[model samples]
Target: MADRWYPMGVPSFSRLAHEVPEPGMLVAHDRALYRVIVVHEDHPANWAEKDRNRLVQNRRAVEERKRHRARPLPREVFYPSPLDGWDGSEETWPNRPRGVELQPMAGGKRLHAGWPHPGWAYWYPVDEHHPVCASCGEPFPCREVDAAKEAARQMVKVEKLMAVGPSCCWHCGEPITSRQGARTFPGENLLLPGGPSPSFHQRKTGGCLYAAKEYEKKWREANPDLAETADLFGPADA
Candidate 1:
């Protein structure tokens, strides 16, 4: 005989949502962009309870994302990170390990991924009032006129100093002395003779400012057997 027992409580399909993995999807909720790591798919009837319950579900992800401005992605991961072009409002799919790709559904022009925040460890904040835009000569904090100020930064010879600051090195947290002006000439090359390549943010900024070449020459004089690692980004354990 076939069973005839009816389920007492009906299930609601609308309540179900995709279950994402670690370092979950970056998305906007409550009119703010954030990384959402979990979802509580209880019945629509139970939304009032679940809405609050979701706070517990997403507490860690919210905390991790709030650490945003303070914790910048390193140059290594930054280079190939699919998150490179990611703006916060759209979805950033976490397909790659420790990284994300901008969601295709959000088909508008992207904003600069919030420049990595310089936490206490690496960068000291730079401040300039009425700083001229390196590109258009407009005043900076120029969100309305031209966004993605990458060009402006480069025009100012921010070169690597653009990584995280007013005018300083990200590696050592020191200011870039002898800037000579508010901006350096475009195409200027400020690099130490024998340090990490300009491909490295440290090499371009502190490598030149800190007299690393002199120190390197002396260090090489002292010891000459340590081989430079091919991958400055670090070893690939996986």
Candidate 2:
């Protein structure tokens, strides 16, 4: 019923002629459920334009078929007939179309159906009971799953950093040893606020230096007065 309001599920298609349902309402057509996205009155000009395009497309398709029919079949098919050993029994010589082939079996050869028709042969509608998010239109529990994954990753990272010990570089999470140049920042660490200040290895590409600068920038923004007097960027440790 178009006049009747459907809270959920597919509405009757018979009443669609009386009144078109508003956008977002689900309707059943040819046993498949579809969500009506838009409703508008058909224009005569639009129909005429469509008819002209259809005629052009039909003519082009006909011409393509004629051209295909004119072309000769593959040379291999003519040189040796694919049906050379057919015994005239339906079981032995099942209809082997142009592309079908025969493969060796335990006793003899058996017909293989070959590849299926190109593209999707059939499409099944989404189950009505299938859960989906109203906001994102993604499968149900989308954001919650993503949030959980992120939390798990963060927990793993924290455990790894703990295993590396406090003397490790905050940026790369590796212990600062005598092998590489290391520098320490003297401000409140942005990653571990109120905790001990973190040090970073002076990588050749200055990646650690950039991370330190970013940390200092955030610290300066938080404590402007202290940042103005503090020398956060000190010389690298020998």
Clashes (backbone N, CA, C under 3 Å), per candidate, total: 0, 0
Best model per lDDT = 2
Error of 1 at 231 (Å): 25
CA lDDT, every model vs. true structure: 0.33, 0.49
Question: What residue runs in model 2 are displaced by over 4 Å at the alpha carbon?
Answer: 1-36, 39-138, 177-180, 234-238
Question: What tens-digit string does per-residue lDDT give for candidate 2 at 92-187?
Answer: 332211122322212354333221122112211234465555776544334544566568877886675455458888887777888877766666
**lDDT by residue for model 1 (132-229), tens:** 44765433333333334445645554544445444544345355566321112112133333323222122444454344434334444444443243
Query: Lowest summed lDDT over 10 consecutive residues: which window, candidate 2?
Result: 115-124
Q: Clashing pairs in model 1?
A: none
RMSD of 1: 22.1
- Which residue runs of candidate 1 sit more than 4 Å off their true CA positions? 1-38, 41-104, 107-148, 158-238
Q: What TM-score, over all chains together, does every model reach? A: 0.17, 0.39
